[model samples]
Target: MSTYHIPVMLKECLEGLDIKPNGIYVDVTFGGGGHTRAILEKLDGGMLYAFDQDADAKANAEEFQQHRSFTFVESNFRFLKRQLRFHGVKQVDGILADLGVSSHQLDEGSRGFSTRFDGELDMRMDQGAAVTAKHVVNEYEQKDLIHILSAYGEVKNAKTLAAAIIRARGMKTIHRNEQLREIALTCAPRGREMKYLAQLFQAIRIEVNDEMGALHEFLEQTPEVLAPGGRLVVMSYHSLEDRPVKNFINAGNIRGKQEKDFYGNIIRPLESITRKPIIAGEEELERNNRARSAKLRVAERVQSK
Candidate 1:
């Protein structure tokens, strides 16, 4: 992999939190420790807890000193609140989650998070996770397949693609990218193979990891865990992930309904740190095209009256 992690909007994220020397912080995605390392530099006696589900991430822990203030948790960040509680900490100053697959996962063909590579269709963020791209292709029913393709991938011919997978599974297994691609080709829009295939793979990867589900849980707990005036810096790479973030931030709840008070005024739990989600600057885009889709939403906790 050329870059282990190309931290998107590093400067912007750092500024979003306005990190304090004594404040506690958490980096939910510790891919290559880029954000964790950056957070570490800004802390004096502050505690930094880094979490990554991939066991390989533990190997990268050697890059930083085993400091008193820094600790690593080899688990999913979806349990951000529970894990923090284990450390006997509450109400952190800030929390950062760079959601979805890491650059290293995509860059390495074996992990198969990207359509660019022809590796096995195994896209489990945590290797221990039971489901994989193979399971989605071979096991899911037509309707469920369509749901995943449309919900996570936004694939145009979702029903057709789901039908194809269903028919193909009747004959034999579709395990690797090559086999899945061959089956998907029949349903994919002709001359639009790459994008369509990418969508399908993305959909499978999201299901395999439960990325959106986990994000929802974390966001639900955000208001409770963050200190008053605490910051949440989240970077989402696509609409599937960004949409919920958009909805949850704009309104108090993910359902997008206004929370009415006695006066019928909408009571919101969060105030947008940025009126609009921040995007990568041109220079950053030149270095990493992945930054093109990255949408950052920062919010501060609002105390309930």
Candidate 2:
């Protein structure tokens, strides 16, 4: 599993969870099950439930099927609450979500996640998803492309890039990663072609997976799914993901603005445990490059009065 993905900030994530020996836990993005395995080791009578929409992840989880303490759900974390209910789990002691593309997905060229590859533009994290990167690139209107690029990728010249894509697709359908990369290069800044291309791909991938929407749904359910005092540990790769997470933790909602009650008391579902998001230390960064972009935030469910 280490080769598949050397779970970023493993030590920090564990410490953030502050695992209890008998606490029920959920690893929302199971990936290679590295964090899930670590959680299992700390539990004596506790149970660990893992969720992943990717079929490959479900296959990876087969390794733990014999362990009565572990259960894997073949679904996205967006359905966190409903899935838990199906399993007879009303609440959990802790939940951990690593909101980054898995190493396996990026390294596998056919998955169409990396600019370094020239595979089909099919970046659906869940292959079963209706939309794919190809659809976003070829079928989306120019204005929609601009929005996705600007909002999801933070591209500086999204409008120009969108025009380029529109023109390119008109000549011939953009079906491959290299094909889209070529179109993006025309609008890329002179010296930062690689960065520009990466941003373009990131935008399409986010749209294909509806990453932000799913994140919001999963977060909305966290306050209800977590037992009082239970931890919510999330590691996000980009600002698109981290910003909402930060807001939800600090303000108890994605809007990042406090909602007050009739008595002027703030209504919040969780309290931020870390004053700021935790980044990988020099040691972890040296061991795993993926750790460089990781931002981990910890929160505890606020008890109702």
Candidate 3:
């Protein structure tokens, strides 16, 4: 587990939860069980429920099987409310979500999540997913590719890159990361090849995994699954994810638009605890490069009048 993936902002995330020794908590992205282990340590007889879609993560959860207080659900956090219901859990004290791909997935060449790895064009976080990165690269229309690269990746030259992909695939299918990278290099600006490729891959992976959609679903259910005053701690790695999370915490919805009651009181479901997202400290940055992009936000469920 030590090498699976280093937990980003470990101390900060644990602090954000403001853990209760005997309260029920959930770790939605139980990547390598690093944070799960820490949460378990804090609990005496409390419960720590973990969720992970990847089979590899499920196997890692087995390491904590000896602790009866720990429960692992082999499913996506998008199904948060329902899965918890299966375990007779109606509400929780806190929920911690570490968004984006885990370091283990990136380091494993076969997963095709890293720019350094020249592997198959398969970026599904759950291997069972049907739509692989190869499908998006080879089958998506030019306009669709442009939209994905522009919106999901924030790639500046999305138009040119999308056109290049379409043209290159006409000669042969883009079935490998190296093959796609070669085509992307043709459009990448000087000295920025890696950055462009990273964005490109991010865009494709998000689309294949329906990350934005899943995040929206998960956020919508938090109000129902968390008890009043329960904490919602999320760590996101990109602006695309951070924006929605920030919006939800601020406006009580992803659109960032406020709703009011007949009495003119704002009908917010959660209260923001961190005005600004937390970042990794210098000491942690030195130990793990993955922490460099992490941004953590904490909020607590609002009590109903």
Model 3 residue 297 CA deviation (Å) reads: 0.5
Give one digit per residue, the lDDT tens place, for model 1 in 256-294. Answer: 776778998778778888999999999999988878889
Off by over 4 Å in 2: none
lDDT, candidate 3, equals 0.92
Candidate 3 segments whose C-alpha is farther than 4 A from its true place: none
Per-residue lDDT tens digits for candidate 3, residues 1-305, read 89998999888889989899999999999999999999999998899999998989988998898898899999999999999999999999999999968888987888888788889999988999899999999999999999999999999999999998898899999899899889999999999998898999999999999999999999999989999989999999999999999989888899989898999977778999998999999999999988999999999999866
Candidate 1 wrongly placed segments (more than 4 Å): 303-305
lDDT for each residue of candidate 2 in 46-105, tens digit (9 for 90 to 100): 999999999789889999999989999999999999999999999999999999898888
Give candidate 2's TM-score.
0.98
Worst 10 residues of 3 by lDDT: 100-109
Q: Where does the lowest 10-residue lDDT sum fall in candidate 2?
A: 1-10
- 274 Cα displacement, candidate 3 (Å): 0.7
RMSD of 1: 1.6
Q: Give the number of colliding residue pairs in candidate 3.
A: 0
TM-score of each: 0.95, 0.98, 0.98
**TM-score: which is higher, 1 or 2?**
2
